[model samples]
Target: MDVKEGNELKEFNMLYKEVDELYHRIALEIGLSDSAFFILYSIVEFGDGCLQKDIADHYFISRKTINSSIKNLESNGLIELKKGKRRDMHIYLTQAGQKFVEEKMMPVFELENGVFEEFTGEECRQLIQLTKKYVMLCREKIKETYHLSSEDL
Candidate 1:
Protein backbone atom coordinates (compact mmCIF):
# COMPACT_ATOMS: atom_id res chain seq x y z
CA MET A 1 0.00 0.00 0.00
CA ASP A 2 1.23 3.47 -0.89
CA VAL A 3 -0.13 5.04 2.30
CA LYS A 4 -0.81 8.20 0.32
CA GLU A 5 -3.80 9.32 2.38
CA GLY A 6 -2.65 9.11 5.98
CA ASN A 7 -0.65 11.26 8.37
CA GLU A 8 2.51 9.99 10.11
CA LEU A 9 0.53 8.97 13.19
CA LYS A 10 -1.96 7.11 11.03
CA GLU A 11 0.78 5.33 9.13
CA PHE A 12 2.28 4.40 12.47
CA ASN A 13 -0.99 2.88 13.63
CA MET A 14 -1.43 1.00 10.39
CA LEU A 15 2.00 -0.53 10.66
CA TYR A 16 1.43 -1.33 14.33
CA LYS A 17 -1.87 -3.08 13.61
CA GLU A 18 -0.28 -5.39 11.08
CA VAL A 19 2.75 -5.96 13.27
CA ASP A 20 0.57 -6.73 16.26
CA GLU A 21 -1.56 -9.18 14.33
CA LEU A 22 1.46 -11.05 13.00
CA TYR A 23 3.02 -11.19 16.44
CA HIS A 24 -0.20 -12.34 18.08
CA ARG A 25 -0.78 -14.99 15.46
CA ILE A 26 2.73 -16.34 15.72
CA ALA A 27 2.63 -16.30 19.51
CA LEU A 28 -0.68 -18.13 19.62
CA GLU A 29 0.66 -20.74 17.25
CA ILE A 30 3.57 -21.28 19.64
CA GLY A 31 1.37 -21.40 22.77
CA LEU A 32 2.64 -18.13 24.21
CA SER A 33 1.27 -14.67 24.55
CA ASP A 34 2.45 -12.15 21.97
CA SER A 35 4.22 -10.01 24.52
CA ALA A 36 5.96 -12.90 26.25
CA PHE A 37 7.16 -14.40 23.02
CA PHE A 38 8.54 -11.08 21.83
CA ILE A 39 10.37 -10.54 25.09
CA LEU A 40 11.83 -14.01 25.07
CA TYR A 41 12.73 -13.84 21.41
CA SER A 42 14.55 -10.60 21.96
CA ILE A 43 16.53 -11.95 24.89
CA VAL A 44 17.50 -15.00 22.92
CA GLU A 45 18.58 -13.04 19.88
CA PHE A 46 20.62 -10.53 21.83
CA GLY A 47 22.18 -13.04 24.25
CA ASP A 48 22.13 -12.98 28.10
CA GLY A 49 24.56 -10.18 28.86
CA CYS A 50 21.72 -7.78 28.15
CA LEU A 51 20.76 -5.93 31.28
CA GLN A 52 17.10 -6.15 32.30
CA LYS A 53 16.79 -2.40 31.85
CA ASP A 54 18.32 -2.60 28.36
CA ILE A 55 15.46 -4.73 27.12
CA ALA A 56 12.99 -2.04 28.08
CA ASP A 57 15.27 0.61 26.66
CA HIS A 58 15.73 -1.16 23.35
CA TYR A 59 12.09 -2.11 22.95
CA PHE A 60 10.54 1.14 24.25
CA ILE A 61 8.61 -0.90 26.80
CA SER A 62 8.25 0.05 30.43
CA ARG A 63 10.61 -1.40 33.00
CA LYS A 64 7.72 -2.77 35.04
CA THR A 65 6.29 -4.53 31.99
CA ILE A 66 9.63 -6.15 31.11
CA ASN A 67 10.08 -7.16 34.74
CA SER A 68 6.82 -9.10 34.78
CA SER A 69 7.51 -10.71 31.42
CA ILE A 70 11.01 -11.72 32.51
CA LYS A 71 9.57 -13.27 35.63
CA ASN A 72 7.20 -15.37 33.59
CA LEU A 73 9.97 -16.44 31.21
CA GLU A 74 12.10 -17.36 34.22
CA SER A 75 9.38 -19.37 35.93
CA ASN A 76 8.86 -21.34 32.74
CA GLY A 77 12.54 -22.40 32.76
CA LEU A 78 12.96 -20.67 29.44
CA ILE A 79 15.40 -18.09 30.76
CA GLU A 80 17.49 -17.17 33.77
CA LEU A 81 18.80 -13.98 35.34
CA LYS A 82 21.99 -13.33 37.23
CA LYS A 83 22.62 -10.48 39.59
CA GLY A 84 25.20 -8.04 38.30
CA LYS A 85 27.55 -5.80 40.27
CA ARG A 86 24.96 -3.22 41.11
CA ARG A 87 21.19 -3.28 40.74
CA ASP A 88 21.50 -4.64 37.20
CA MET A 89 20.48 -8.15 36.27
CA HIS A 90 21.82 -10.02 33.27
CA ILE A 91 19.49 -12.19 31.24
CA TYR A 92 20.36 -15.47 29.51
CA LEU A 93 18.40 -17.90 27.44
CA THR A 94 18.18 -21.54 28.49
CA GLN A 95 18.51 -24.62 26.28
CA ALA A 96 14.77 -24.77 25.81
CA GLY A 97 14.69 -21.09 24.98
CA GLN A 98 17.28 -21.51 22.24
CA LYS A 99 15.46 -24.38 20.61
CA PHE A 100 12.11 -22.66 20.87
CA VAL A 101 13.36 -19.48 19.27
CA GLU A 102 15.09 -21.25 16.42
CA GLU A 103 12.05 -23.39 15.64
CA LYS A 104 9.55 -20.56 15.78
CA MET A 105 11.59 -18.01 13.85
CA MET A 106 12.33 -20.14 10.81
CA PRO A 107 8.75 -19.96 9.54
CA VAL A 108 8.54 -16.33 10.58
CA PHE A 109 11.51 -15.52 8.35
CA GLU A 110 9.99 -17.44 5.50
CA LEU A 111 6.83 -15.43 5.88
CA GLU A 112 8.88 -12.24 5.91
CA ASN A 113 10.78 -13.22 2.81
CA GLY A 114 7.62 -14.16 0.97
CA VAL A 115 6.10 -10.80 1.74
CA PHE A 116 9.06 -8.46 1.47
CA GLU A 117 11.47 -10.13 -0.93
CA GLU A 118 10.26 -7.91 -3.73
CA PHE A 119 12.09 -4.98 -2.26
CA THR A 120 15.43 -4.15 -3.88
CA GLY A 121 18.61 -4.33 -1.88
CA GLU A 122 18.70 -0.54 -1.65
CA GLU A 123 15.13 -0.48 -0.49
CA CYS A 124 15.87 -3.14 2.11
CA ARG A 125 18.79 -1.15 3.43
CA GLN A 126 16.62 1.95 3.49
CA LEU A 127 14.01 0.14 5.48
CA ILE A 128 16.60 -0.93 8.05
CA GLN A 129 17.89 2.63 8.33
CA LEU A 130 14.35 3.93 8.67
CA THR A 131 13.70 1.45 11.45
CA LYS A 132 16.75 2.68 13.31
CA LYS A 133 15.67 6.26 12.81
CA TYR A 134 12.25 5.55 14.16
CA VAL A 135 13.71 3.79 17.14
CA MET A 136 15.69 6.89 18.00
CA LEU A 137 12.65 9.07 17.51
CA CYS A 138 10.65 6.79 19.79
CA ARG A 139 13.40 6.89 22.38
CA GLU A 140 13.28 10.66 22.46
CA LYS A 141 9.51 10.71 22.69
CA ILE A 142 9.57 8.16 25.47
CA LYS A 143 12.12 10.16 27.39
CA GLU A 144 9.93 13.21 27.03
CA THR A 145 6.84 11.42 28.23
CA TYR A 146 8.34 9.21 30.96
CA HIS A 147 11.24 11.35 32.13
CA LEU A 148 13.54 8.38 31.80
CA SER A 149 16.74 8.57 29.79
CA SER A 150 18.42 5.64 28.10
CA GLU A 151 21.56 6.36 30.10
CA ASP A 152 19.79 5.51 33.33
CA LEU A 153 17.62 2.75 31.94
Candidate 2:
Protein backbone atom coordinates (compact mmCIF):
# COMPACT_ATOMS: atom_id res chain seq x y z
CA MET A 1 0.00 0.00 0.00
CA ASP A 2 1.14 3.52 -0.79
CA VAL A 3 1.38 6.38 1.73
CA LYS A 4 -1.95 7.65 0.44
CA GLU A 5 -3.66 4.37 1.31
CA GLY A 6 -2.02 4.40 4.76
CA ASN A 7 -3.22 7.96 5.34
CA GLU A 8 -6.78 7.00 4.41
CA LEU A 9 -6.77 4.19 6.98
CA LYS A 10 -5.46 6.63 9.58
CA GLU A 11 -8.31 8.97 8.67
CA PHE A 12 -10.72 6.08 9.21
CA ASN A 13 -9.31 5.76 12.72
CA MET A 14 -10.14 9.41 13.34
CA LEU A 15 -13.73 8.76 12.27
CA TYR A 16 -13.86 5.80 14.63
CA LYS A 17 -12.52 8.01 17.42
CA GLU A 18 -15.28 10.54 16.80
CA VAL A 19 -18.00 7.89 17.08
CA ASP A 20 -16.40 6.51 20.26
CA GLU A 21 -16.29 9.98 21.77
CA LEU A 22 -20.05 10.34 21.37
CA TYR A 23 -20.71 7.02 23.03
CA HIS A 24 -18.27 7.85 25.83
CA ARG A 25 -19.96 11.15 26.60
CA ILE A 26 -23.41 9.53 26.66
CA ALA A 27 -22.17 6.76 28.98
CA LEU A 28 -20.35 9.12 31.35
CA GLU A 29 -23.49 11.17 31.97
CA ILE A 30 -25.16 8.01 33.33
CA GLY A 31 -22.23 7.37 35.72
CA LEU A 32 -21.04 4.24 33.91
CA SER A 33 -18.12 3.61 31.65
CA ASP A 34 -18.82 2.58 28.06
CA SER A 35 -17.77 -1.01 28.78
CA ALA A 36 -20.06 -1.41 31.77
CA PHE A 37 -23.03 0.17 30.02
CA PHE A 38 -22.58 -2.11 27.02
CA ILE A 39 -22.55 -5.15 29.27
CA LEU A 40 -25.65 -4.09 31.11
CA TYR A 41 -27.40 -3.12 27.92
CA SER A 42 -26.71 -6.47 26.30
CA ILE A 43 -27.92 -8.39 29.33
CA VAL A 44 -31.15 -6.44 29.57
CA GLU A 45 -31.80 -6.41 25.86
CA PHE A 46 -31.45 -10.15 25.66
CA GLY A 47 -33.75 -12.21 27.82
CA ASP A 48 -31.24 -14.90 28.68
CA GLY A 49 -28.77 -14.05 31.40
CA CYS A 50 -25.41 -14.68 29.81
CA LEU A 51 -22.64 -16.73 31.33
CA GLN A 52 -19.44 -14.77 31.95
CA LYS A 53 -17.47 -16.65 29.33
CA ASP A 54 -20.42 -16.59 26.92
CA ILE A 55 -20.66 -12.83 27.21
CA ALA A 56 -16.95 -12.54 26.50
CA ASP A 57 -17.32 -14.84 23.50
CA HIS A 58 -20.29 -13.02 21.96
CA TYR A 59 -18.76 -9.59 22.49
CA PHE A 60 -15.30 -10.64 21.18
CA ILE A 61 -13.68 -8.94 24.17
CA SER A 62 -10.95 -10.43 26.31
CA ARG A 63 -12.09 -12.50 29.30
CA LYS A 64 -10.03 -10.32 31.60
CA THR A 65 -11.58 -7.16 30.24
CA ILE A 66 -15.08 -8.59 30.64
CA ASN A 67 -14.27 -9.66 34.19
CA SER A 68 -13.01 -6.18 35.06
CA SER A 69 -16.09 -4.55 33.53
CA ILE A 70 -18.37 -6.96 35.34
CA LYS A 71 -16.60 -6.14 38.58
CA ASN A 72 -17.12 -2.44 38.03
CA LEU A 73 -20.81 -2.92 37.19
CA GLU A 74 -21.27 -5.07 40.28
CA SER A 75 -19.60 -2.45 42.40
CA ASN A 76 -21.89 0.24 40.99
CA GLY A 77 -25.03 -1.77 41.88
CA LEU A 78 -26.03 -2.12 38.26
CA ILE A 79 -25.78 -5.89 37.97
CA GLU A 80 -25.77 -9.05 40.04
CA LEU A 81 -24.96 -12.71 39.64
CA LYS A 82 -27.77 -15.22 39.43
CA LYS A 83 -26.66 -18.59 40.77
CA GLY A 84 -28.37 -21.37 38.91
CA LYS A 85 -27.96 -24.92 37.59
CA ARG A 86 -25.01 -24.05 35.41
CA ARG A 87 -21.43 -23.91 36.59
CA ASP A 88 -20.84 -20.59 34.86
CA MET A 89 -22.31 -17.53 36.52
CA HIS A 90 -25.36 -15.92 34.89
CA ILE A 91 -25.11 -12.15 34.88
CA TYR A 92 -28.22 -9.96 35.06
CA LEU A 93 -28.95 -6.32 35.72
CA THR A 94 -30.44 -5.22 39.01
CA GLN A 95 -33.72 -3.26 39.20
CA ALA A 96 -31.72 -0.09 39.68
CA GLY A 97 -29.78 -0.93 36.57
CA GLN A 98 -32.97 -1.39 34.56
CA LYS A 99 -34.35 1.87 35.90
CA PHE A 100 -31.18 3.71 35.04
CA VAL A 101 -31.28 2.39 31.51
CA GLU A 102 -34.94 3.32 31.19
CA GLU A 103 -34.37 6.85 32.45
CA LYS A 104 -30.77 7.59 31.45
CA MET A 105 -29.95 5.27 28.58
CA MET A 106 -33.22 5.83 26.72
CA PRO A 107 -32.45 9.53 26.44
CA VAL A 108 -28.91 8.80 25.33
CA PHE A 109 -30.24 6.52 22.60
CA GLU A 110 -32.76 9.20 21.66
CA LEU A 111 -29.94 11.67 21.17
CA GLU A 112 -28.02 9.19 19.04
CA ASN A 113 -31.14 8.46 17.02
CA GLY A 114 -31.71 12.17 16.49
CA VAL A 115 -28.19 12.43 15.15
CA PHE A 116 -29.17 9.89 12.45
CA GLU A 117 -32.73 11.04 11.89
CA GLU A 118 -32.10 11.56 8.20
CA PHE A 119 -32.58 7.85 7.71
CA THR A 120 -36.05 6.32 7.34
CA GLY A 121 -37.21 3.57 9.68
CA GLU A 122 -36.21 0.76 7.33
CA GLU A 123 -32.93 2.50 6.55
CA CYS A 124 -32.17 2.75 10.24
CA ARG A 125 -32.72 -0.98 10.77
CA GLN A 126 -30.65 -1.84 7.72
CA LEU A 127 -27.88 0.48 8.82
CA ILE A 128 -27.76 -1.01 12.29
CA GLN A 129 -27.71 -4.55 10.89
CA LEU A 130 -24.93 -3.72 8.49
CA THR A 131 -22.94 -2.01 11.21
CA LYS A 132 -23.11 -5.09 13.43
CA LYS A 133 -22.04 -7.31 10.54
CA TYR A 134 -19.16 -5.00 9.72
CA VAL A 135 -18.04 -4.92 13.34
CA MET A 136 -18.12 -8.73 13.50
CA LEU A 137 -16.07 -8.96 10.34
CA CYS A 138 -13.52 -6.56 11.77
CA ARG A 139 -13.25 -8.63 14.95
CA GLU A 140 -12.79 -11.84 12.97
CA LYS A 141 -10.16 -10.19 10.81
CA ILE A 142 -8.27 -9.00 13.87
CA LYS A 143 -8.27 -12.51 15.34
CA GLU A 144 -6.94 -13.94 12.10
CA THR A 145 -4.27 -11.24 11.86
CA TYR A 146 -3.09 -12.26 15.32
CA HIS A 147 -3.29 -15.99 14.40
CA LEU A 148 -5.69 -16.42 17.31
CA SER A 149 -8.45 -19.03 17.55
CA SER A 150 -12.02 -18.18 18.45
CA GLU A 151 -11.36 -19.80 21.83
CA ASP A 152 -8.20 -17.76 22.21
CA LEU A 153 -10.21 -14.67 21.37
Candidate 3:
Protein backbone atom coordinates (compact mmCIF):
# COMPACT_ATOMS: atom_id res chain seq x y z
CA MET A 1 0.00 0.00 0.00
CA ASP A 2 1.13 3.55 -0.77
CA VAL A 3 1.04 6.58 1.52
CA LYS A 4 -2.21 7.70 -0.11
CA GLU A 5 -3.81 4.32 0.56
CA GLY A 6 -2.72 4.40 4.20
CA ASN A 7 -4.08 7.92 4.63
CA GLU A 8 -7.39 7.00 3.04
CA LEU A 9 -7.79 4.01 5.38
CA LYS A 10 -7.01 6.17 8.39
CA GLU A 11 -9.49 8.83 7.35
CA PHE A 12 -12.24 6.25 6.79
CA ASN A 13 -11.63 4.66 10.19
CA MET A 14 -11.72 8.06 11.89
CA LEU A 15 -15.01 8.94 10.24
CA TYR A 16 -16.47 5.56 11.28
CA LYS A 17 -15.43 6.10 14.91
CA GLU A 18 -16.79 9.63 14.90
CA VAL A 19 -20.16 8.47 13.62
CA ASP A 20 -20.33 5.73 16.30
CA GLU A 21 -19.53 8.25 19.02
CA LEU A 22 -22.25 10.54 17.72
CA TYR A 23 -24.74 7.68 17.80
CA HIS A 24 -23.84 6.94 21.43
CA ARG A 25 -24.37 10.56 22.44
CA ILE A 26 -27.67 10.87 20.59
CA ALA A 27 -28.94 7.54 21.93
CA LEU A 28 -28.23 8.59 25.51
CA GLU A 29 -29.85 11.97 24.98
CA ILE A 30 -32.99 10.18 23.76
CA GLY A 31 -33.06 8.01 26.93
CA LEU A 32 -31.69 4.85 25.36
CA SER A 33 -28.50 2.90 25.57
CA ASP A 34 -26.39 2.96 22.41
CA SER A 35 -26.97 -0.72 21.69
CA ALA A 36 -30.71 -0.41 22.34
CA PHE A 37 -31.00 2.53 20.00
CA PHE A 38 -29.18 0.64 17.23
CA ILE A 39 -31.36 -2.42 17.73
CA LEU A 40 -34.55 -0.37 17.77
CA TYR A 41 -33.45 1.54 14.69
CA SER A 42 -32.82 -1.70 12.83
CA ILE A 43 -36.22 -3.09 13.81
CA VAL A 44 -38.00 0.08 12.71
CA GLU A 45 -36.07 0.29 9.48
CA PHE A 46 -36.59 -3.35 8.53
CA GLY A 47 -40.20 -3.39 9.62
CA ASP A 48 -41.74 -6.79 10.46
CA GLY A 49 -40.16 -10.23 10.01
CA CYS A 50 -36.69 -9.09 11.02
CA LEU A 51 -34.95 -11.97 12.75
CA GLN A 52 -32.40 -11.86 15.54
CA LYS A 53 -29.83 -13.54 13.29
CA ASP A 54 -30.50 -10.89 10.65
CA ILE A 55 -29.76 -8.11 13.10
CA ALA A 56 -26.62 -9.86 14.23
CA ASP A 57 -25.43 -10.20 10.63
CA HIS A 58 -26.46 -6.68 9.74
CA TYR A 59 -24.41 -5.20 12.57
CA PHE A 60 -21.62 -7.81 12.31
CA ILE A 61 -22.02 -8.28 16.05
CA SER A 62 -22.49 -11.37 18.16
CA ARG A 63 -25.87 -12.93 18.87
CA LYS A 64 -25.16 -12.36 22.56
CA THR A 65 -24.82 -8.62 21.99
CA ILE A 66 -27.97 -8.55 19.92
CA ASN A 67 -29.82 -10.63 22.52
CA SER A 68 -28.88 -8.14 25.19
CA SER A 69 -30.05 -5.25 23.03
CA ILE A 70 -33.31 -7.01 22.19
CA LYS A 71 -33.95 -7.68 25.87
CA ASN A 72 -33.44 -4.03 26.69
CA LEU A 73 -35.76 -2.85 23.92
CA GLU A 74 -38.42 -5.39 24.85
CA SER A 75 -38.26 -4.40 28.50
CA ASN A 76 -38.73 -0.77 27.49
CA GLY A 77 -41.77 -1.74 25.40
CA LEU A 78 -40.09 -0.39 22.32
CA ILE A 79 -40.14 -3.72 20.45
CA GLU A 80 -41.44 -7.27 20.62
CA LEU A 81 -40.66 -10.66 19.22
CA LYS A 82 -43.14 -12.67 17.21
CA LYS A 83 -43.15 -15.93 15.33
CA GLY A 84 -42.42 -15.42 11.66
CA LYS A 85 -43.92 -17.37 8.76
CA ARG A 86 -41.00 -19.80 9.02
CA ARG A 87 -41.54 -20.19 12.78
CA ASP A 88 -38.46 -18.19 13.51
CA MET A 89 -38.38 -15.42 16.10
CA HIS A 90 -38.82 -12.04 14.43
CA ILE A 91 -38.47 -8.58 15.84
CA TYR A 92 -41.01 -5.79 15.43
CA LEU A 93 -41.41 -2.33 16.84
CA THR A 94 -44.39 -1.60 19.06
CA GLN A 95 -46.70 1.40 18.71
CA ALA A 96 -44.83 3.18 21.44
CA GLY A 97 -41.60 2.47 19.62
CA GLN A 98 -42.94 3.99 16.41
CA LYS A 99 -44.16 7.04 18.28
CA PHE A 100 -40.83 7.49 20.01
CA VAL A 101 -38.97 7.18 16.72
CA GLU A 102 -41.26 9.71 15.11
CA GLU A 103 -40.72 12.13 17.96
CA LYS A 104 -37.05 11.42 18.58
CA MET A 105 -35.10 9.29 16.08
CA MET A 106 -36.36 11.07 13.00
CA PRO A 107 -35.17 14.37 14.36
CA VAL A 108 -31.78 12.91 15.14
CA PHE A 109 -31.50 11.56 11.60
CA GLU A 110 -32.65 14.87 10.18
CA LEU A 111 -29.88 16.63 12.09
CA GLU A 112 -27.27 14.04 11.10
CA ASN A 113 -28.39 14.20 7.48
CA GLY A 114 -26.45 17.43 7.26
CA VAL A 115 -23.31 15.31 6.86
CA PHE A 116 -24.17 15.05 3.19
CA GLU A 117 -25.25 18.68 2.72
CA GLU A 118 -22.20 19.43 0.57
CA PHE A 119 -22.58 16.31 -1.56
CA THR A 120 -24.85 15.66 -4.50
CA GLY A 121 -27.22 12.70 -4.45
CA GLU A 122 -25.04 10.87 -6.92
CA GLU A 123 -21.99 11.49 -4.80
CA CYS A 124 -23.70 10.06 -1.74
CA ARG A 125 -24.81 7.00 -3.70
CA GLN A 126 -21.32 6.48 -5.03
CA LEU A 127 -19.89 6.68 -1.52
CA ILE A 128 -22.33 4.05 -0.27
CA GLN A 129 -21.56 1.79 -3.22
CA LEU A 130 -17.85 2.07 -2.60
CA THR A 131 -18.27 1.46 1.10
CA LYS A 132 -20.28 -1.71 0.45
CA LYS A 133 -17.60 -2.93 -1.91
CA TYR A 134 -14.94 -2.31 0.73
CA VAL A 135 -16.98 -4.16 3.32
CA MET A 136 -17.25 -7.16 1.05
CA LEU A 137 -13.55 -7.09 0.41
CA CYS A 138 -12.87 -7.06 4.13
CA ARG A 139 -15.24 -9.98 4.64
CA GLU A 140 -13.46 -11.97 2.02
CA LYS A 141 -10.14 -11.26 3.68
CA ILE A 142 -11.50 -12.40 7.03
CA LYS A 143 -12.87 -15.59 5.55
CA GLU A 144 -9.57 -16.35 3.92
CA THR A 145 -7.65 -15.79 7.15
CA TYR A 146 -10.01 -17.92 9.24
CA HIS A 147 -10.73 -20.63 6.65
CA LEU A 148 -14.42 -20.17 7.37
CA SER A 149 -17.58 -20.17 5.30
CA SER A 150 -19.97 -17.22 5.15
CA GLU A 151 -22.26 -18.93 7.62
CA ASP A 152 -19.50 -19.34 10.16
CA LEU A 153 -19.54 -15.66 11.01
The most accurate candidate by lDDT is 3
**Per-residue lDDT for 7-74 in model 3, tens only?**
77888889999989988898999998877787777766676658888878787778888889888888
Q: Cα miss at 60, model 2 (Å)? A: 2.7
Off by over 4 Å in 1: 1-12, 109-117, 128-153
The superposed Cα distance between candidate 1 and the true structure at residue 90, in angstroms, equals 1.1
* Descending-TM-score candidate ranking: 3, 1, 2
- TM-scores of the candidates are 0.70, 0.69, 0.77
How many residue pairs collide in each prediction? 1, 0, 0
The residue-by-residue lDDT of candidate 1 on 1-153, one tens digit each, is: 664665987877789899889888888998887667767767655765688787777777788888898889889987888999889898887888777767875567687788678899899999989889987988899899999978954
**What is candidate 1's local distance difference test score?**
0.79
The residue pairs that clash in candidate 1, if any, are 48-91
Best-first order by lDDT: 3, 1, 2
Comparing candidate 1 with candidate 2, which one achieves the higher TM-score? Answer: 1
Indicate which candidate wins on TM-score: 3
Q: What is the lDDT of residue 98 in candidate 3?
A: 82
Task: State, as a TM-score between 0 and 1, how close model 3 is to the true structure.
Answer: 0.77
